[model samples]
Target: MREVAFIKQNKEKWLEFEQAIFGNLKKNPDDLASLYIHLVNDLSYAQTYYPKSKTVVYLNHLASQTYQKIYKTKREDTNKLIYFFKTEVPLLVYQYRRYVLYAFLIFGILTAIGVISARNDDTFVRLILGDSYVNMSLENIKDGNPVAVYKSGSNWGSFVGITFNNLRVGALSYFFGIFLGFGTFYILIINCIKIGTFQYLFYKENVFWESVRGIWIHGSMEIFAMVIEAAAGFALGASILFPNTFSRLNSFKIGFKNTFKIFLSTMPFTLMAGFLEGFITRYSIDMPHFLSVFIILSTLSAISYYYLIYPFKVHKKINLKNT
Candidate 1:
């Protein structure tokens, strides 16, 4: 069907939905849910046939509002926290998967820049990482304990400090989305550059594997969570930049609520990373290669599955049920 005809056919129903949604018309919970299902069907159709049209964007916005309304109307007697992780966060992640891709792509580019700059400019590493840290790392390398920095603090102290610091970084990466995401991008760039340079330093000292075994024991989850937090920030910014059918303020409110949930989802992974860093990373030098590799790969795999693979599964399940 032509876009105009499609809109002509459904516009009245949509307007009625708008009335029902905003409380201009009375709607029972089941009635609103049925209407929401119809709206979703329309949304799916628009996505398929008029993907680039304003009609599609409008339908998406309407569908989101309806979904929220349905949830509000029918409060399930379930654990809110468990439902958040199991259903809500996964759906949000799937909805904003593109932003996550963009964040990772940006991270890759910035990291490459760091690697190339560190390789070409002799002073670049020290400039980015600081001279004192560089000197200390070099001495540690000489002492054949290349990642000995992990051993500096007691386990509990390091765990608390590292967790707090990581949480702080994640929060900044999220809240900085208020600046149209540039602030979040800056945060990501700084961290990825430092990471690239730090890794390159290890490669330079012929202890690349040593660095990986020590750092990635926790770095796997830590770094991945940071990228995801950045993705949430991007979503928040996009909400402001393109409000679709919503007022800019309303768009921002929805975006902040959804994206903030996504940010919160990363907390457990970050905490686990901190635990591994404080307790296990300090023993990396004497740890067996296979064990270290397993820990690193396991943490990376767990996080990767949650953010990348599991969201699709949940999305599919929901779609199937709705269909």
Candidate 2:
């Protein structure tokens, strides 16, 4: 094909590849493989048919820059991973923290409302929780057990099912962010409401503490994973809303890429939450109160440390090195 015709025929693909390589450069500046491939292609095409053209000059410049970048591949990889942990993850944590604060605040305010309404009208719990769940819990409470629900499912079956279900929910929450952020917010709102109402139902039975100890053992990880998923959603949405220096399409592409990483990070947490809910929660009633409290606090601390504190520390270290 003639040079112009070749350029015309493959222009779209070239542009797409250019954008992809450019985006990766911002995140992984020393990704030599991509840089090399892109540079070689552009250089070969330009040198072959556009020897005296301005495009040839541009291609040479880009190729030289890519070669320099390739030399720092090791440094770049390390910096990128550090940057992701520190800068990227922490920002996500901050967003998640905001969402959590909002979720809890809304939950607390609604619980107060539920309590007030329940006091004024005995049937309020029924309206919120439905009569069946309330009745079953009441019976369990009377029998000196406030959290019999955890024991209802078969152990092995519950573990597999709950784990699969929670992972699916987390994945969906992340995936739905493709619609921007509304889909993620919707997931957070629904779960917050369910948790609040569920807590209120137990509060009605005067077993709120018991319920919290039993439920939050697993709920901490599950809910936190959900929040991370929401952050992923926000990431996806932000790409569309604020591309910053990048084009909107480029932004969306990057956002989805980061969100996918975040989703992958939450898998182990989902499994842990499922294990706690399916197996550990049932035994909480049988275990000593102090032991249960310790387990809950320790898990919370670990989650907070890894997702919150660790990222910040990593970020600071990276920033210092970069500076």
Candidate 3:
């Protein structure tokens, strides 16, 4: 329908809602909630069909007010955590998948910069990955054991330390979203550049395939989860930066809840990555080529399906249920 016709259709109900809130047309909390849900359904339709219409803005404002009223008197769902993972997080991922895509793009571009810079300037590798790591890799390469660094530590020790560090990085990536998301961007810059330079260092030594054989044993999940965490950070920052019709504080609460759920969702992947790094990666060179590829592909596929494919499926299911 045209925007004008759409508004005309809902304008009377809109005025009724305004009066309900402003003129104190008393209603039970559950009734207010029922109204809120129906309003959101309308708002969702407006967003999909008449996104640029002022009707969407008006509906969003009205829905948010209803939300606030309902929430103030709402009872907590005891299965909230389970519900969050099964429904809420998937919906949020579908909603903010663009942020995730942006994270991947940022990572790719910065990594490409690192690779190009390292290829052009010998010092670029040292600058990005640091002299100590670059020198160590070079020494290991000269020793014909380019990825020996993966074997330097004990499995359990590496597992604990690596997992701990990855969690810290993940938390920082998500928390930094508070700084208008530059925090996550900066984190991505550092890591992606380092990855590019480090990979190029192997490439320079002509151990590119050999390096890939080892690094990807765990790097697939490790890297993918980090990128996802960065996306969560961006989503968090975006909530604060663009509150839409909601109050800034309310938007932040929504953003914080959403980002935290997304961030928490990555924990299993991060721990699995650490496990692969600790127990599995050390043997990457000795493992059969097929086995290495299997581990990498399986991890990559699992994360890819969950993040990329599963959300769309969940969205369709939700849509079907709502319909």
Candidate 4:
């Protein structure tokens, strides 16, 4: 048959094949096996009837790829896990570094602005933190404790509560990417400003180093996760703005998948941050200086190694392999 004649004769079958491949067909194991058989038959028909047509060419390619995947499912499963860690995770970490740098730069500038404003005005902390919170902190500081707020709840309760809250925030930060990433940016800016203002308050009280050592014991992990969340948001946003070779819908689907992976990756860090904040921050003043420094340094080191060093190492290995 001629290409046009073949397409017209088998158009319904082609539609069914397309639906099976990309539509919501709800395939059980038996149904999946039947669908694969149908796909193979359709490809055979297209090859026989319209060998030179684009439809035939595409169907041939699709059938070949699908057959390989279906036949090697068990083998691919193991390789896919290895591929995710060695390739996908490292690339994600690398993308997050750019977002981290952006967040840091913005926060640093805001911090400088906060410090300048605080130095020039006596009530800047009260303005930034609200009068009530400042009063409470001042009272706590007067009692020789600056971070007593975290110690109010039972440790286990605090851990569960704080972990749940952080997870919610991280999930929201990711889900908002469905709105094209504006929500993530909004959250990031608000958090960054709060940190800047909060730190300036400590600086104003001449307790900057003490506050840094206290807060950053957990803040390093918490803040890095936030930046990673923002990077996921960027991926979602960029998928919409620049679909590249893929259709907009396809790009968005891929972007959402990547972003979801990144969101999942932040869970452990979120829990660790919660633990430090709820349990460790309360005793910062009592903890040995070396221990506090060590926690902070260790947290930073882990961030550097995971996001920067490890990713570069993986990329270098991949490049060497390709060469």
Candidate 5:
């Protein structure tokens, strides 16, 4: 069938679904579920036959909204917390996956610029990292403990302080998106450049391996969570910039709800990173090389899987159930 014909046939049903979704009309859970299943079938048909048609897009959007409505109606009976992490956030992440990619690409570019700038200009590291930090790191390198910075405070104190600081940074990275995402970009620029510059300093001192072993034991999850936070911010910003079929206010509301879930998901990983930095990173200097590598890889893999791989898995599972 032609796309126009397909849309014409389904248009009335889609409108009624939208009215139930967006209007003041309240729907019963079972009725909503029935409608949702019907909408999903239409969406599947449109995707297969109409492919790139706006009808498919419209049907898909309606199906998603209907699914949410069904979930909301059933929320009273479900374990909300488990349902949140297990299903809601992952769906939101998959839906806005592009923002994550954009955040990482921007971070990569800024980091590269930092590395290139530091490589060409001897003073660039000091300018970015500050003279005091450079001198302290140089002294640490001379003393054969390139990451001794993590050893300064008591473990408990360090954990609390580091965790609080990381939380604050993540919050800023996300809330700053209100400025249409430039504020979030600014946050990423500051941190990513510092990362590049800091890593370059160790490389310049010929202690790259030492720094990696020491820093990355916790830095892996810590850094990855920060990037995810930035992605959340970008998603928030994009809502304002491209409201699409939504009013700017409604778009921002939906964007904030979904993106905030993504931001909230990073909290556990951030805390874990702080714990490693406080207790484990201090031992990285003398720890077995294999052990350090394992910790680094494990933390990185766990966080990466949750944000990247697990979302896809959850999305697939949900889609299968809908089918």
Candidate 6:
């Protein structure tokens, strides 16, 4: 379409947006998000087809202001944070549910590979888990305390260190999506393989049940958070690789914005895992079998409901909202 025609088409909508911005704000945030998405689409087309025209410049400025209004700006209050997790995040999780499934699928497949490889070769575990780790586990097994490794560090130190490290790994996985998501996949593969081989080693030592009761007291949340991080990364990479109707930059903007929230969603779970591993896992074997099972199942159920089931409910409610 001609530049004049384009300007004529969107000029009134832009004027309305200008009015909304300068006047009292009344639109629902979700409604504003829809407007921002359409505005971005228009801005992207203008940049592509009429880069030298005033229309392009005008749209660019308008889009920038709208983005600031919709995403970057918010009323200052505690409810803002609550609304973020309670509403904004769950909806995005529902929107990108496929990426979460893809991440889980990749982790599952590679985990199977790790188990198969380790079972087929004695050296495979050592190769993947490193000689030191394998030897330490063997020594621990010989000492009749196969899960003593969690006892190495002070509980508080371990709590702080583990939480920081988990967040770092999660953040790295999310950021690596900048490399077209391949980097994130590599991290996910490495992590899944580590879990597989390590567990298989416990199995080989005839401590499979004991290992499960000890490890999964914390591993449920820890491993699940890592998988969610991989989902965030994959979501980012998918956005870049398949911008669909939006321009590459605009798609990326949406991807990063939403996935960053998804990444944030993993934080409380990561901290919970860290706390359990530090304060609880060291004594897991000493606890009653029923208690161990209870803890593990409870953690799994919480994560499953939050990341999987709850998002659907939140999405449904948001759709039914009058706005």
Top lDDT prediction, candidate number: 1
Better of 1 and 6 by lDDT: 1
lDDT of 1 by residue, 261-321 (tens): 9999999999999999999999999999999999999999999999999999987886687
Clashing pairs in 1: none
The residue-level lDDT of candidate 2 at 15 comes to 54
lDDT score at residue 200, model 5, on the 0-100 scale: 96
Local accuracy of candidate 5 as per-residue lDDT tens digits, 1-323: 88778777877787778778876777798988988888888888888987887677667666766787788778776788888888787878888898999988998999999999999999999999999999999999999999999999999999999999999999999999989999999999999999999999999999999999999999999999999999999999998998866689988987898799999998998999999999999999999999999999898888888889988998788788876
TM-score of each: 0.93, 0.69, 0.84, 0.71, 0.94, 0.79
Candidates, ranked, lDDT: 1, 5, 6, 3, 4, 2
Q: Residue by residue across 38-78, what tens digits does model 2's lDDT show?
A: 65676677788878875675454344334334434444445
Those runs of model 4 whose alpha carbons end farther than 4 Å from true positions after fitting are 1-87, 95-103, 110-124
TM-score-wise, the better of 2 and 5 is 5
lDDT of 2: 0.68
Pick out the ten consecutive residues of candidate 4 with the lowest summed lDDT.
65-74
Candidate 3 lDDT by residue in tens digits, 84-126: 5665667678778999999999999999999999999978887
- TM-score ranking of the models: 5, 1, 3, 6, 4, 2
CA lDDT, candidate 4, residue 316: 65
Highest TM-score: which candidate? Answer: 5
lDDT of each: 0.91, 0.68, 0.84, 0.69, 0.89, 0.85
TM-score of 3: 0.84
Report clashes for each candidate as comma-separated counts. 0, 0, 0, 0, 0, 0
